[model samples]
Target: MYDCIEAIKQRKLKKIEGETFLVSEKHILKARNGDEYVGLKLKDKTGIIDAKIWNNLLHLKDRFEAGDFVKIKGESNYYNDNWQVIIKDLERLDEKEVDKSAFLPSTKRDINKLQEELLGLIDSVKHTGLKKVLEEVFLKDDFLERFSKAPAAKTMHHAYVGGLIEHTVSVGKIASELAKDYDGVDRDLLVSCALLHDIGKVYELDATTFNYTTEGKLIGHIIIGYTIVQNVIERLNVLSQEKKLNLLHCILAHHGEYEYGSPKKPKTREAVLINMIDMMDSRMQPVLDAKIDDSTGWSEMIKIIGKSIYAPKKAPKELL
Candidate 1:
């Protein structure tokens, strides 16, 4: 297969192996030579790269649009500290032939194991009514299936299949551990809030294309989650006025600030803790998903991250 960077250097070539990627952006222009060229921002799960088509041999502009996947034959080259590809050959690909996993970045963590651990934490909750309510929502056959497969966000942070669960579990674990250090924070409540804060994402995102739904775009996940939790609280016939209000507050304030999408700022200690943990988990995802190749070492200088990470160097045998 043509690795992305390798394609930019082999100009005047007929074909090269490389994965198909979505054209996130396209700019077609006329070069000084009077030949038509297309500038493209191509992206896959690993990351995005700049690509340019200078030859007039192909009608790529007519065939592909933004968000459509295209297999490209190109040579890799550097331009102003960035890697780019010079297109040599290209073809639009069928949906069935394209692996969705290859198109979306994912957490390096094992999803199934993380999910099971999260469920076990849910089971450990000592509060009878809270445990029952959580079980009712999480154990629903349809919701469980969809939640297990959904993406947490459209493009930010955890945006891949099973990403919702990974992020929730991470936040839940952090909140649970922090509860041990503080007396005001209820471990069960904090963990439950973290796990369910983004549960609405199952409805917020379209599973097939991994894009936001109309409701997701219009209402947002926080409101959707609050609605679901309120419905569950009403259906369960449990939870006192104080407990119910506190739970809702956590969901509403998990985004931390109004500007960040939280309708209400965190009020309760549990809500504050949940918000902090959620932010911590979300920020760590980009670093965890960064690509490192055998030759490239740690690819710390992600344009999105704005910093470079160095791989851990090997130690001398004497140290061992």
Candidate 2:
């Protein structure tokens, strides 16, 4: 067993020596006095910590990259309510020497249960062409395996292992229920889109580390997922041009705004529903996981959502 990041606290353990932390982020910053220092974000299975290298920086500066495992001589401290490490000496560790599992965070939910639910949704698509397209799409190559394990984003919501599959299945179930109440909505198409709206994330993110690749940064998961869907439609010849176009439109417009990277706005009922569900899933997740602050009765401000969420003092009387 390894020492967990959450266990090393400034108010508790106080100091540790010669600990290994994965280098998730690395950069150089110029100080006010014209001195340069290395800035880093170190991570482990529990969480991440801001770290700094202030001594003998030049000799070890080029030895490591963002993804490498580095052993460090450091002292941990709490500063402004956050933990950061001041590294005294460090050396890059080889991939084989480091235990990769220690650094990756995993979803707590059961993966098998999630996949079973997803397969059920895939079966629920009533459109013959769309069903066939989806079957051929998932069954081909090793796409299913990769999709089962990918994260929904590099950071922010659902960044841990198996997050993509969990989010997809959970949202698909919700969208399926929501579509049943609306007359014009196509539940089958909406469910299919819900299942696949973020499939591109499998290709967009680094499979093991959950970081964006160069292609992921440049092309983004939306276009990459769109391209994947377009290729499936071309080779399988399963759907009519209109169905294909609408499906592609849902994927492209799911982001809901031009500024947010959607190429077009949702035009069809199914597309709109898909957008709503995707947004609902991505936004709700972080808030649900946000920790409560006892003093202020609010969670720490979430930069992505731009506000701290308030934690209610007591459970509802209805629930009680």
Candidate 3:
């Protein structure tokens, strides 16, 4: 078993047989000859690499799936300037046979520290009704464990483990300060909304293999989160009708527009602010994390963010 894929070498020409995560796989046919093969992507904690199965395509197609723990028998080779695996045999691994930590990428942030900060923010809310609701959402022992390990997205910003809590704590802190600058903003609602905006994401993204679950693909996090909030309100019966309506509106409309999956547009001042805060954090984090400079001091155009990002080059020491 390899601790990291980056340590593997193409020149060595060795067989790699151990636990590798199945990032994706597909059936493809050759154009002229009309022969079939399975194209696949495999990952470890370090990185992912392309792979292919040339034989037994029909037999292997249903044996595993995306986000599965696969025990592979393959040889590493260089192809198209990258390392690819030519798999000879493969088998799906049961949960008992695999270590869950080896196949996933996690956030570098300290999990316990982030949880403490998140709880502190939840405790700081002065409004009794809102505070109680936040507690019910965040205080559950099981939910905290999952939230602290959940990814914010499958591929985009904050995709690693523990990303949800990292993002939530950051947005809560910033939203708290941002709310102070505006007049007539409900601080409690804004801060709580900031904390709860992506609640459903914990369920939306599968942490083990960083893929979408059935609920994630069917309903998405926005609607899923809105429904959860509605249920909590109904059971608790704490907040007034107006406060409940506004809180639900922020969660439903946080995406800002229908095209982006928000069922409603942000109407109230807090809703608009919540949307802005969410957008800024989601956009800025990915840009800051990117290291590809394209030799021009600008990152390659990331389609998801809508524009290329800038990072200033370090001048030579002579200039300094």
lDDT of 3 by residue, 232-305 (tens): 88889999999999999999999999998899999999999999988888887778765444355665444458
Candidate with the greatest TM-score versus the true structure: 2
Q: Which whole-number lDDT from 0 to 100 does residue 100 have in model 1?
A: 68
> Model 1, residue 6: displacement in angstroms?
11
Q: Where does candidate 1 have its weakest 10-residue lDDT segment?
A: 5-14
- By lDDT, the best candidate is 2
Per-candidate count of clashing residue pairs (backbone under 3 Å): 10, 0, 0
How many clashes show up in model 3?
Answer: 0
Q: Relative to the true structure, how large is the alpha-carbon lDDT of every model? A: 0.76, 0.80, 0.79
Q: What would the TM-score be for candidate 3 when compared with the true structure?
A: 0.79
lDDT of 2 by residue, 1-320 (tens): 33546665413445656677778889999889999999988877655668888888878788899988888887877566556788888888988987776567767788888878888888988898888878877768988888877888766778777889988988899999999799988787888888778888988899666678888999998999899889989998888888888899998999999998898899999888888888888888878866555555666555468787877667457757
TM-scores of the candidates are 0.78, 0.88, 0.79
TM-score pick, better of 1 and 3: 3
True lDDT of residue 222, candidate 1: 88
